[model samples]
Target: MEEISKHTIHEQDIVEMILSIGKKFERIVLRGAYEDILALFKKLKKKEQSPQHYYQEQYDQYQPSAPPIPPDSAELFDYYCSFEVHDCYEQVDFEGKGLVDNVYVPLLEKVCNIHPSLLECQRKRTYKYSGWAFNALGRVSHFLETTKLEEMNVDACECLQMLWDEVQVFGFELSWLAPQVEFALNMEKFMREVEKLEEEKKTIFMRIQELRMKFKEELYFLYI
Candidate 1:
């Protein structure tokens, strides 16, 4: 029974260690994404004024055929939020197929274990936002490839701003996973404590056994 308990504790410890490593990897990936977004934001900000000026002029001159959809409509909002206006001058396609698959999808699957509907909503939102980002980045790449230096600066600023917005939205959606992550972290800590206690118990048991042996030997000597 003692041996079985030890084996079970050892297996639990291994599982907890693996989970700790997985959490660390997730945090590292998130930090990398955050840094990338910050760099992109700074790059766009430097050239953003030019594109804003041009867009404002265009906005003032253009007439809309249809009124904009209300933000409260979930389906419409999701579609609108994910919408990307593809530029004709796009030179390269964005490789977005595996972006969500790499992290968000798997994370959502884990979250679904806690709340399936919440997971579904978050998953949809994540994909929409990430898809918009992919499209925006693709447009930026296109502009860089085909546009003159001045035009590239303007388009890059515009596309990068769009991409930045999508990334921000994606980050917000991802934050919903925080509670689950916290719970998992707490569980890992609890498991560590359990492992420590188990070790202490084993040591105390071994000491008790040694004292029992000593008592038996003294009793035998007295009898002799």
Candidate 2:
């Protein structure tokens, strides 16, 4: 095996790092290869930090559970292609497609099945932070339907809608204020609809009040 250089931070360096730290940090191996080497470097530093500062120490205090590995969809597709009847993944020149299917899929399914609560939290909307919940929900929803999700005990089945709603809210406000080149078209259309609706609502309210006042005057006149 060719030894990866210390300064080079390519995918190969990550593979080397994982293999080097495997015995001490089997958990790190579960992360997707798509994660950058720099990110892995930060994670490795965190792992080495004192038990008091991090949960890994506390987690290891008790018998720690195995890290959950998500199935690599790319890998699974490649495996399917290899069946001779189909060769769909041949066109895409991507690495790690095989490992995703072989290693990550079963691990992710098991983790999701066991910890639907954790998954549900991730599925919640907090766009200011990580969008893992929405991303995870999209992936899961691609595989399973809302009816099937009922079996999993998820409280918020509308995670995707919520994510979209939040994005629209943020995008609408930002677009209206900044109207950047990318958002100009959508922003103008959205604002026009919003303004029309507001004007229509105000008109309806005024009409209702006018009718009420007319009825009141008519009643007072009849009494006099």
Candidate 3:
């Protein structure tokens, strides 16, 4: 009886560790995927602007005054395909697709390849374990009503053992996924920092341009 209790405690510890690792892995994968999609959008922004230089020249000559409409998903996909770096992923069809299907899932798969199964486990495990817990509680309740203490103990121990085994399997999977998860997370952080620096550079250049224009205006006024 004492040995059974010790084993149950050990299993509980493993379960907690598995849950913590699984949650962390899920969060990192999702966050990294989101950042990757944002990076693609940034690339699309640069591509969309490439044509604008020509438009600006034409506008200076003709004074055309059409406001730009934002690109829809299809347009974004087209621009995404135009990038040489993303040529490998261009064949991925995005027709009538949601963000998760087109962007997050694809990026996650590119990084780790185990994303689908990991996502399934992350989403389903809670509900799966909750159902098992409820069923086990009901059985324990019935056993108590019948005054069957030994049976109740056995049933509870079985539930614990099942949970322990599931946790072990999940932990093993996460162990292999850990390196990829860390890489994705670090890549996301690097992308964000690069974007921030680019924005700052743009801001500084605009300020310098504004100062130059102001200096020209002052010189013109002085000459007048």
Candidate 4:
């Protein structure tokens, strides 16, 4: 039997490791490594090929004849849980933390365990954590709501503001990733329509510029 070295990985280990890392990392690196990891997986999937043999000329232009159906139920549950968190946080319900504790945390744990993908993983984690943080901060705001202006401690308010700012930062990052992924997927479709290539490219570029301007001018203010 061949000894497994530190750098050598068995096929199943690779999948589990990819899934585990998928939960923790930022998107850029996660996406950048996708093709190589996928290639490795393809190799492992074939009975006749060694891991390196899968990338040779014999495997060139090979494609899966059938596309796998996306697991919609799991995706839908994550999205629903995410929306609930958003709604609860925005409503400024001081007891929103209860909902987060009972609902959002479990959703987050399940999503992480499933390791859906980087975009969804980051979105779920950020949404749940940010909602919980925001809800806690809201409770602090409620406390200050009842306290006389003169009785409020500057330090506590400052700390709460900092926590709120962190939540906003995470929310902004999560929101940006969602639209960016949408743009990427749309770009793929747009590129495929050869007859409309020039026009669609122009439209996509223009829309991207518009999104940037709106994000800077409108969304920035609201979050701040």
TM values, all candidates: 0.25, 0.18, 0.20, 0.19
After superposing candidate 1, which stretches have Cα over 4 Å from the reference? Answer: 1-177, 217-224
Candidate 1 vs candidate 4, TM-score winner: 1
Expressed as tens digits, the lDDT of each residue in 1-224 for candidate 3 is 23423543332232233234454334232334334433544554554342224333533322101001112332443353331111122222221111221222233333233333433444444544422322222222222223222232333334333323333443223344333223322333444555676675565445545444443343354346
TM-score, cand. 1: 0.25
lDDT of candidate 3? 0.33
TM-score of 3: 0.20
**Top candidate (TM-score):** 1
**lDDT string, candidate 4, 1-224, tens digits:** 12323355543454344455554434323333444544544543453332224323443332111000012222443343331112222122212222232323333334223333412423445444544543432332232233332322344334334433433443332332233222222332333333354454455445545443432343244335
Off by over 4 Å in 2: 1-93, 96-191
lDDT tens readout by residue for model 1, 1-224: 33423543332233333334454334232334334433443444454343324433533422111001112332543354343333122222113221322222333334334444433433445544534433332232332223332332333444434434443442333334333223322333444544565665565446445444443343354346
**What is the RMSD, in Å, between candidate 2 and the native fold over all Cα?**
32.9
Task: Tell me model 4's lDDT, rounded to 2 decimals.
Answer: 0.34
Full-model lDDT for every candidate: 0.35, 0.33, 0.33, 0.34
At residue 180, what lDDT does model 1 achieve?
26
Q: Which residue pairs come into collision in candidate 3?
A: none
For lDDT, the strongest prediction is 1
Model 3 segments more than 4 A misplaced: 1-176, 211-224
lDDT of 2 at 51: 26
On a 0 to 100 scale, what is the lDDT of residue 170 in model 2? Answer: 20
